[model samples]
Target: MGISPELRSLNLSNNHLEGPLTVSSIPLQLQSLDLSVNELNGPLLLDIPIPEQNFSLEKLLLADNKIEGPITASLGTMTSLYILDLSNNQLRGNIPDSLGNLTLLTVLRLESNHLNGEIPACLTNLSELVMLNLASNELEGQIPKELGNLAGLASLHLEKNNLQGLLPLSLAQLSNLQVIDVGENNLTGNIPSWIGTCSSLLVLMMRSNNFKGKLPPQIGELTELLILDLSSNLLYGEIPNTYLNLAAMVVVNEDMSVVGEDRHAPSARRVRPCGAPSGARSRHPPNIRGITPDSDHNYYGTCVDYVYGNEDRRYYIEGLDLITKGSERHYAYVLSGMACIDLSNNRLWGHLPAKIGNLKGLMFLNLSRNSFNGDIPGSMGNLSQLESLDLSLNKFSGKIPFQLGSLDYLGYLNMSYNNLSGVIPQQGSHMITFDKSAFWGNPNLRGCPVESWKCSPPHSPLSPPTIDVKEEAKEGFSWYELSMGWSVAAGFFAVVLVLTFKVNWRKTTFDQMDRAITFLLGERTN
Candidate 1:
C-alpha cells in the first residue's frame, strides 16, 4: 500500500508500528510526519539521506517511541521544519547543534531522554522558538543567556537536570513567556527580580534548588501567575508582603475566559500523568505543530495524560501535578480554577499576611518547615475551597483559629511542631478527623485528639503541722490551762518538801499565807 508522494501529512502515531523509520519509505513531498507512541527503535537518521534540494518537511514528531542513539546532524537539512519533538524516548548523546539551523522552528522538545553533555547554545539561533523543553535529561551546564533571544517563547521547562549556575538575566526579555520550571537542579544565587518583567507569567516553579536570599518583591508584578512554588530551598527572610500585590492570586477569578481557549493552538500542554509526580511517565508527549504565525501563541494549557484503569485507552486534560493531601494529584481540565501557593521548607519568618485570605479560590496552601511565627491568620478561613493546609514546623504561637474549622472542604490539616496553645478547635469533622500527629508537638496546646493535660504540683511532707485552737478550748483540758495546773501542783509539792526539810522555810511560807488571807477579807468587807 504505497501512499502518494504528494501526501502532505502522514500521521502514523498511536499505532503499534515497529522497526526503524527508513528514509526510502518517506515521501519526498511530505510536509508533516508523526511517528510517535510506537515501538520504533534504532539509530535516528543513520540510513536517512540528506537531500541536496530544499526538503518540503515541516513538522517531525518521533517522540514516545523506543528511538535510541544520537540525534543526527542530518536533521539540520530540513530547513523548513518548524516543530520537532524527539522527547520521551531512549535518545542518547548531546543534542545535535546542527538542528539549530531550523531557524523557523517554533517548538523543540527533547525532554525525558538520556541526552548527556551541555545544551548546545547554538540552539538559541532558533529565535522563532516558542517552547523548549529539555527537562528530565542528563544534561548539565549553565542555561545559555542567549535563550533570551527567543522572544516569542511562551513556556520553557529545563527542570530535573544537572544544570547549574544562575538563571540568565536575558530571560527577562522573553515578554511572551507564561511558564518557567527550573526545579530539581543545583542552581544557585538569588532568584532574579527581572522575572517579574515577564508580565505574561502564569506558572513559576523553582523548588529543590540551592537558591538563597529573600524572594524578589518584583515577583508581585506577575499578575497572571497561577502557581508559585519556591519550597525546599535555603531562602531566608520574611516573605515579601509585596506578594499580596499579586492581583491575579489575591482576587478570585471566577471566569478564566481571558486566558484564551485555543487548545488547538501550537503551544506546550505539559501533560502530567495520573498518580505521577513531577517527572513521571507523562503523555500527550508535548504535541508539536506548526502555527500559522498570525495566531496569538499566548495560552499555556497544561494537561495530565493518563490511561484509564479499566481499559488501556489513554486520555488527557488541561492541568498539572500538585502535592495534595500528602500525595500527587492530577487536577483535571479546570486548571484555570486552581490556585496554589507553596513556599515551605525555607528559612522564611514572620507572620503570614492576612492579605492571602483574599484568594477565596485558593485550594492548596503549604507554608511548612519555616521560621514563621504568629497566629494562623483567621482570614485564611475565607478560603472556603481550601482542601489542604500545612503550616507545621514553625514557631507559630497562639490558638489555631476556630475559623479554620469552618473550612468544610479541608481534608488535610497539619499544625504540628508549632508554639500554638489552647485547645485545638473542634468545630468541624475535617479538623476532628486528623490524627494526633497533625496537632502534636505544641506542649501548651490541649485538645480532644491530642493528650495534653495540665500537670499538678506535688505535696511536700516536711511542712509544719497546723494547730486547732477551737478544739483545744472545747476540750475539758485546754492545753494552756492544763499546763498551768501541772506547774502549780509540782511547785506546791516542791515547797512542802522544802518546808519539811527546813523549819525556817516552813515559818516564812505560813506568814505569807496569813497576810494574803487578811488582805482578801479586807477587800470583801470594803
Candidate 2:
C-alpha cells in the first residue's frame, strides 16, 4: 500500500468522515495531505514533530470541515510548510501570526470563518507568498498595500471585511496579478490607472465603497480579462468607449450614466452597498434608488459588457466610476439583450430614448426618480417582452401610450408622481392587481377616478349625421321645392276661377257701364 514507508501523498476529500483526527501513526514519509470538503470535527492536536519524521509537508489542505479552536501557534513547527488552506469551517479566534514563520509558505487561504482582528502586518514579510484569501471574515483596518510588493501574487481576495482608506497606489506593481476582489469593504479614492495596466489581470471587484474619480482608459487593453466590477462607488467621468467591448453583468449597485451609444459617465447617486436599504431586500445590481424592475422581456438583443463591482450574472467590467458626478444626465443607459437593469435612486435625466426598444430582451427596467420628460414613446410597444416597468417620479407629459398594453408580461407598473396624462395602459397582469396608487398624480389620465378624487369622465366619440343633404337633393328635390310646384298648380286653378268670375263681373260691368256714363257725373260727385 502507498501508506507504507515509501508513500508520499494522502488525499481524503468530499467524504462524510467525522470525529477527531490525530496523527499518532508511525508512518512519517508523507509529503502532502488533503482532507478537505468533509464533515470532520475536532481540533488539530498534533503534538509530535510530524515534520521531523520525514513527513515534511509541502502542502496541507483541511477546508470545508468542522475544525474548531484557535490555530495553534505550534503550527510554526512545520517549518517546511509551503501551502496551507483551512477555509470553509467554524474556526475561531485570531490568526496566529507565528504561522508566518513558515518562511516557505507560498499559498494561504483562511476564508469563510470567524477569525477576527487586524490582518497581521507581518504577512507583508512573506516575500514568497503567491496566493492569499482571507475574505468573508471579521478583519478590520486598512488594507496592507505593502502586499503589492509580492510581485509573484496571482490571486487575492479580501472582500466582506471592514478594510478602509484609499487603495494603495502600489498595487500596479503586481504585474503577475490575475484576480483581485476587494468588495464589501470601505475602500475609497480613485481607481488607480496602474492597476489597469496589469497585463495578466482578468477578474477584479471593488464595488461598495466611497471610491471616486474616472476609470482608467488603458484597462480596455486587458484582452484576457473575463470579469470586472467597480459598481457602487463615488466615481465620475464618462464610461470609456473601450469599456463597451467587455462582456459581463455586474451584480452590484455601481451607478453610471449611459451618456450615449459609446459614451458613459460617472453619476452622483449613492450606489447600494453590499447589503440593501431598510424594508427593501437586496436585489441584483445592488440597492439603487430610481431604478425599478422589468421582466419577461421577449426582446433578445445583443449582450453587452457590464462593468461593475458585483459578482454573478456571468459578466463584470471595471474601469468605470459613478459617484463623482452624482445623478445628472445618466439616462438612455442601454446594454442590449433581454436582461435586467435596476437603476433606482440615481440622478439620471432626459426622456427615455426611443431606441430603448432595441433591448428586446429587457425584462426589468427601472428609471424612477429621474428628470425624464415628454410623452412615453409609442415605440415602447415593441418591447412585448417587458414585465415590470417603473418610470415614476419623473416630469413626463402627454397620455400614457396604449402600446404599453402590448406588454402582456407586464406585472408592476409605477408611473406615479409624474405629469403623465391620459389612460394608463390597461393591459397586463398588474392592471387589476394595481389601483390608483400605480398612476397617482397623473391629473389628465383617463379612467374611473378614485372615489375620493373628483376627476370628470373621459370624453366620448361623436356620432355622424344620418343623411347627406346634397347627395339626397341630387336624387330628389327638397320638400319645400316640391311644395312650390304644388303652389304653382294651385295658382293656375285659382287663375281659371278668377277668369270665370271675371266674365260674370265683366257682363254686369258692361251693362252697368252704359248707365255708368249717365250716372258717372252723379257717381263722381258722390
Candidate 3:
C-alpha cells in the first residue's frame, strides 16, 4: 500500500499482516503506530533518514508479534517518543544503550523478549519514566542502583531473569512506586526494612529468591498494600502482629476508580487529527487519513483516533502470578478489590497473630508448610471474603475453630498435617464441600468427612440425651421386684384371715389329710 506523508496515526492492530516493517512505509508525520497482536515477522528495521528534530513520532507499539533481531539503535534518535512497547516479541541481543537518550520516555516495555547482557545503567537517565518493565528476559548482573533516580517511576518489574545481588537501598527513594516485582531471580540479602517507606506500594513480590532473615515488621506500614508474596524464601520468624495495620486488607473497597491511577501526573497530551497537517490545498481534505469526510470537507475525530484519552489509564497492573485454590493463576491484571498474602514455604514459626481477622477483605491466605503452632484462630471466621486458605503442614494444635464454618465465601481449605483436633467446621455451605484430603495427615483431627476418624458427640447443652437402655431396664427391674414382694405379702395375709374366719372348712381339710396318710402307711406295709 502506498503511504501518505500526511498520515499522523496508523493503527492496524490485531490483523494478519505478515513480513518485516520497513522505514519507508511509516509516514514522515506519523505520531503513533500500533501493529500489535499480529503475525508480523522478521527484524524490526526502522532506519528512517529524517532529521532528528523533524521526527514527530511519539508512540510505537509492536507488542505480541514475531518480530526478531536486535532493536535498532536508530530508534534512539526519536527524541519525541514517550511510550515504546516492543514486548512479547522474539527480539534478541542486548538492549541498545542509545535508548537512554529518549529522556522524555514515560513507559518503556521490553519484557518477554530474549534480550540479554547487563541492564544498561544509562537507561536510568530517563528521569520522566513512569513505568519500566524489563522482566522475563535473559538479562544478567546487578540491578542498576541508579534506577532510584527515576523519581516518577511507579512500577518496576525485573522478575523472571538471572539478575543477582541485593536490591539497592537507593530504591527506597521511590516514593511514588506502587508495584515492585523482583521475583524468580537469584537476588539475595535480607529484605530491606526501607521497603515499608514506599507508602504508595500496592503489590510487593519477592518470591522464589534466596533472601533470608526475619521479616521486617516495618512492612506492615504499607496500609494500602493489597497483595504481598514473599513465599519460597529463607525468611524465618513470626508474622508481625502489626500487619493488622494493613487497612486495605481489612475492608473491601467497592470504588476501584483509584485502584491503579498514575501517581505521577500524565504527561501525554490528547491529540486529534487536525485538517491534513495545515498545508493541504484540496477543496476537500482527501480521505487518505482513513477517515470519512463530511459535506463541509471536514472529518470528525473518533475516540479511537486519539492517543491516551481513549481508555481508562488507571486500571493498569501488567501481570501477576499468584497461587490460589491450590494452583498457580496468572492474572493479566490484579482484580481491583482483591487482597492476598502468601508467606508459605518459609521457616516462619510461632502462633499466627489472632489479629489476622482484621483483614476481612483478604481473599487468599497461604501460611502452609511453616512451624505455626497454637490453635487456629477462630477470628479467621471474621474474614467474610476469604476464598482460599491453606494452613497445612504446620505444628498447630487444638480444635479447628467452629467459627470457620461461618465463612460463606470460603471455597478452598487445607488444614492437613497439623496437630489440630476435634471436628472440622461443617456448618457452612462451603466448609462441607471440602473432601477428606483437606484434613489428611492430622491423626488427631476427627470429623464426618475423615473416613475412620469419627468425631465423638460433644458434651454441650444442645447435645442429645445420653441415657443408656440398660440403665433404664435396671431401674424398671427394681420397681418390679418391690411390686412382686408386696403382692405376695398381701396374698398370704388374705389366706390366713380366710382360714381363721372359716373353721368348719379348715377341720374337713385336716381329716382328709389324716385319712390319706393312714392309707399310704397300710399300702407300704403290705
Candidate 4:
C-alpha cells in the first residue's frame, strides 16, 4: 500500500484535494495525472523521486489550483510529455527553457498565471506544438521569430501582456495558423499584410496598441475570419471596401436563421467534444489550460464560463473581451454565432459603405470617433441582428433614416455630433425611448424629445389679401333704407346745382320761405 510502481494513471479532479504533490508519492511509471479544479496548492516541481532516473509522465493537468513557485527546469526530464497545463494558478517566474527540450510536446498552457519574462525562443524547437497560450500574464518582450518555425501551429494567444514590436514576417509561414490575439499590448508598426496569407485564420485582435497605417485590403483574404478588432489604434484611411469579400461574414449573415431564432436570445453554453484539428498534435493552443480530457483520448475539450454584466454563463471553447453597446463585455462560447468589426477611435474618414449591410449577422459595429462623413447608408437597417451601433463624433450629414427604427434587436444607438437633420423618427418602442441626447448636436433636427427647434408649416410670399365678407354685409343697409338714402342724396345734389346757378333766385326763395313759415305758424294757431 506504500507505493505501487505499476500505477500508470491518477485522477483527483473536482475534489477538495489540497497540499503539494510530493515527488515521493507519485509513481515513477505514471503516465497521466489530473489534479485539476481543486484547491491543490504549493510549489510546482518536476522531481519524481526516481533515484537518478526519468519518469514516464505524459500528460499533466494541474489547472485551477493555487500552485506557486517557479516552473522548474526539471520538467524537461519527462520527455514523453505531450500536454502540460498549469493555468489559473499562482505560478511565477520565467517559463523553463528546458520545456523546449520536449520535442514531443503538443500543448503548453501557462495562461492566467503570474509568470514573467520573455517567451523562451527555445519553445520554437517544439515543431510538434500546435497551440500556445501565454495570455493574462506579466510576460513582456518581442515575440521570437523562431516561433514561425512551428508549421503545425494553429492558435496563438499573447494577449493582455506588455509585449511590443511588429509582427514577425515569419508568422506568415505558418500555413496552418488560425487564431492570433495580441490585444491589450504596446505593439507598434503596421499590421503586416502577410497576415492575409493565413487562409484559415478565424480571429485576429490587435486592439489597444500604437499600430498605425492603413488596414491592408488583403485582410479580406481571411475567408474564415469571424472577428476582427483593431480599435483604439492610430490607424487611418478609409475602411477598405474589400471587406465585402469576407466570405465568413457573408455566409453567417445569410444563414442567420440557422444560428438562432431570436437575434437577441441569450445563448446557452454547452459542452461539446472537439479535438485539435486533424494533423495537429495538442488539444489546445499552448497558452491555455484547464483541459481534463480522459487519458484514453488525445482530443481536447474546453468548458467556458462567462460573466457578462449581471449574469453568469457557461459556454464552450472560446472567449472574447470587447467593447460593445458603449461598454466592455466578456463573451463566452457565443463567439461562434457572433461577428464584429470594430475600428473605432481611429482617424478614418469617408462614407460608410452601403455594402456594410451585407454583414447581416454582425452583432456589433462601432465606427465612432472617426472623420467619416456623408449619409449613413440606409442599408444598415438590414442589420436585423445588430445590437450596438456607434457613429458618434463623425461628420456624417443628412437625414437619419427611418429604417433604423426597424432594428428590433438594437440595444444601443448613437448618432450625436453629426450634421444630421429632420424630424427624429420614433418607429418603435425602443427607438421612442431614446432621449434627446442621442440626437443632440444636430442643429436642424426637430421633433419630440429632440425639440431644440419647433417644426413649422410651409408659407408663401405671394398670396392674396384676406377679405372680411361677413363684416361688410353686416354694415350695409337694407333695400328700404337704401332707397330713402338715395333719394335724399339726389335732392341735396339738385339744390346745390340751383344755388350755384342763381344767387338772386336763392335770396327770393329765402324771403318766400320766411313768409311761408310765418303763414304756416298762423294757420296752425287758428
What does candidate 4's lDDT look like per residue over 47-101, in tens digits?
6544376677767788899999988787776787767888889989998888899
* Residue 430 error, candidate 2, Å: 17
Error of 3 at 16 (Å): 1.4
Compare the candidates by TM-score and give the number of the best one. 3
lDDT of 2: 0.60
**Where is model 4 more than 4 Å wrong at Cα?**
1-11, 27-31, 48-54, 253-317, 434-444, 448-526
How do the predictions measure up, each by TM-score? 0.73, 0.51, 0.76, 0.71
On a 0 to 100 scale, what is the lDDT of residue 278 in model 1?
38
lDDT of 1 by residue, 1-526 (tens): 9888657778899989988776666677887788889999987763455666456777788989998888888878788876788988998899888988999877788888999999888988998776788888998999988898888787788888999999999998988786788989999999989998887777888989999999999987777777788988999998777786566556554432324333332223233222233343211111112223123222234332212222222122123456667666754332444567888899999888888787676777899999999978889888876878999899999888888888877889888899999977754434656788898789887755785221111132564343445688877557767778999999999978998999998899899999999999999999
Best by lDDT: 3
Which is better, 2 or 3, measured by lDDT?
3
lDDT of 3 at 98: 85
In model 3, the clashing pairs are none
Worst 10 residues of 2 by lDDT: 311-320
Reference-based lDDT, residue 475, model 3: 65
Q: Give the TM-score (vs. native) of candidate 1.
A: 0.73
**Better structure of 3 and 4 per TM-score:** 3
> What does candidate 3's lDDT look like per residue over 1-526, in tens digits?
7878767778999999999987766776887888889999999777765454477887888999999999999888888887888999999999998899999887789999999999999988899887788999999999999999999877889999999999998899998787899999999999999999998777899999999999998999887587899999999999987776586787654332322122233323321112222222111111122222331123211001124444322213256788898999986654544588999999999988789999878889999988999988888988887889999999999988888888877889999899888767654434556788999989886656784333324353677534445565776655445668999999999878887889987788779999999999999999
